[model samples]
Target: MQQPPSHAREILRLAVPAFGALIAEPLFLLADSAIVGHLGVAQLAGVGLASAVLHTAVGLMVFLAYSTTPAVARAMGHGQLGKALAAGRDGVWLALLLGIVLAVAGFWAAEPLVALMGAEGDVRSFAVDYLRWSMPGLVAMLLIFAGTGVLRGLQDTRTPLLVATAGFALNVVPNLWLVYGLGWSVAGSAAGTSVAQWAMASVYLVMVQRNAARHGISLWPDWSGIRAMTRVGSWLMLRTLSLRIAILATVFVVTGQGAVNLAAHQLAMTIFSFLAFALDALAIAAQALIGKELGASNSVRARQLTGTMIRWGAGFGVVTGTLLAVAAPWAGALFTSDAGVQSVLTYALWILAAGQPIAGYVFVLDGVLIGAGDAKYLALAGVANLAAYVPMLVAVA
Candidate 1:
């Protein structure tokens, strides 16, 4: 039997790199917010609304990565590398297919969607441009999600860390040049990000292809496998949608509070999101490790791993919460110069920090259940959770 400390070490090994990869997504958004913010309040608000909608849409599809990761890891644990690679290939095909459907729909619906969200005047115009230009990026984003799953399942978190780091680094120059030098404004932010997403997707596709060939797995779509994944993913999608609904509900309430409150909420949400990725790194590690253990029929070991991971999650939450509390004052200044917005943000940050422990536990358990192939239960629980959350939000509002 492995020592308890060994489990901690294993979790850290996977988590450290997963942290880098996961954090990149939010960091990119933070960059967009910071840069677009300089254009004025309306531009910043437009980008925020567009981004919120985009996140909700793509967020539901994240099951592509979550479902694929555990399935591939399980297959690998059974010593079926070829089978695992084939399963992963099906996920990639599904991602590509779904991405195209979403892109078309999103482009067509951009203006109406922005209107539906209650934007008007310059805010509406800027949001329409940002939302439409961002659709192509969705395709690449979905592909990357599926590809990351394959790599993570193959027990190679380092690849995603390296790719995401490079992608983020490359994103900065183009974004600055297009937004400032070329004067594309909000549209430039979307275009620069779209280019980076596609580059990352291309690299992942090549890597996946090479690995498939090495394992003698066919690159062709496996309809049966894809169907199975979709069935599982549908439930996961519901789970994700439930969470997004909660977010949108919160945003809706905040928006009613006035412009300063809305701006503060966006800033606070961005920071909370970035911090979440840190906590989520441990959850990602749990998915890969727990799935592999369960696949090997080591239920006892799987239980042990889950227990250890939960503790790690709690520890991380404590550290993050402390840091967030300490940095709240300075952090607000980094994102904006508005004193009113800064004051509102400072208040929100404290509330977020207070939820860290619960958030950590919930996130880790969510990942563990997914690894155990309990997507249906997770989906049902998501609805119940949302039901509970709405009333609280309403009361607060």
Candidate 2:
């Protein structure tokens, strides 16, 4: 019997690197906000509005990673490495196809979408610019999602950590140079991030290709496999869609409060995302490990892993929440200099911090169920959650 300490080590082995990789995703936005913040309130407010739409789009597609991870992990656990690779390949193909469609639509509809969010004046103009420029990266982002899913399925979080770190560096320098050095404004920020995303996608594609070649898996799209992937992903997508709708609703409400409030909300949301991703690292670990365990028919071990991870998630939340609370007063200064935005953000951070424990628990359980391939229930529950949440949100609005 593996001791409890062994379980902790296993979770940490994946979770630690997963933490770094996960946080880097949000760091992209964090960096964007920090750099764009210094431009001016209108600029900052514009990017904020654009990012809400962008994040919602990306969030809805997260099932690419969510679905592929468990399928690949399960197949690998069952000793079907080739099949696992095949699943990953299908995911990439699906990502590419979906990316193209979304990019085209998003590019053409950027103005309408931003307008729909109630943005106006320079904020609307900047948002439209940012959204249109960001279209190119949509495909790359989805590819990265699928590729990261493949690697996670293969129990290779380290590669993602390395790639994401490099990608972050790649994103920041160009953004700084382009936005400041060349005066590209929000467009430059979007362009730089897009380029970095593509670079990251390329690396993932190469790695996936190499693995498929090594395992003698065909790189060609298998329609049946892709169909199957889509079927599973549909449920997960619904679940994700619900979550995105919630966030988007929140953003819409904030946007109506004026640019200053919207800008503050954006910074606060960005920071919240950073912390959420940090906490989700444990969930990522659970997804990988639990899927493998269940695939191997090791229910007992899966249960044990779940218990350990939940505790870790809660504890990690407590620690992070405390730190966030302590830093709340000054954290806004790191992203923006506007005193009004900073003050609003400080209050938001405190509220966010207080909810950390509950969020941590929910995130972990969500991952556990996802890893177990309980998408149908998750989807239904997600709808239920949204139903329950909308009223509260409306009340606040």
Best by lDDT: 2
Q: Could you estimate the TM-score for every candidate? A: 0.97, 0.98
Q: Candidate 1 at residue 36, lDDT?
A: 82
Query: Could you give me the TM-score of model 2 versus the true structure?
Result: 0.98
Residue pairs with backbone atoms closer than 3 Å in model 1 (clashes): none
Q: In order, what lDDT does every prediction score?
A: 0.88, 0.93
* Segments of candidate 1 deviating more than 4 angstroms: 1-3
lDDT of 1 at 275: 90
Q: Cα deviation of 200 in candidate 1 (Å)? A: 0.8
- Writing each residue's lDDT as its tens digit, candidate 2 over 1-397 gives 4447889889888899999999886899999999999998889999988998888889888999999999989998899998999999999999999999999999999999999998999999999999999999999999999999999988889999999999999999999999999999999999999999999999999999999999788999999999999999999889989988998899899988988899999898899999999999999998999999989999999999998888878888899899999999999889888999999999999999999988898899988999999989999999999999999999989
Identify the runs in model 2 with alpha carbons over 4 angstroms from their true place.
Answer: 1-3
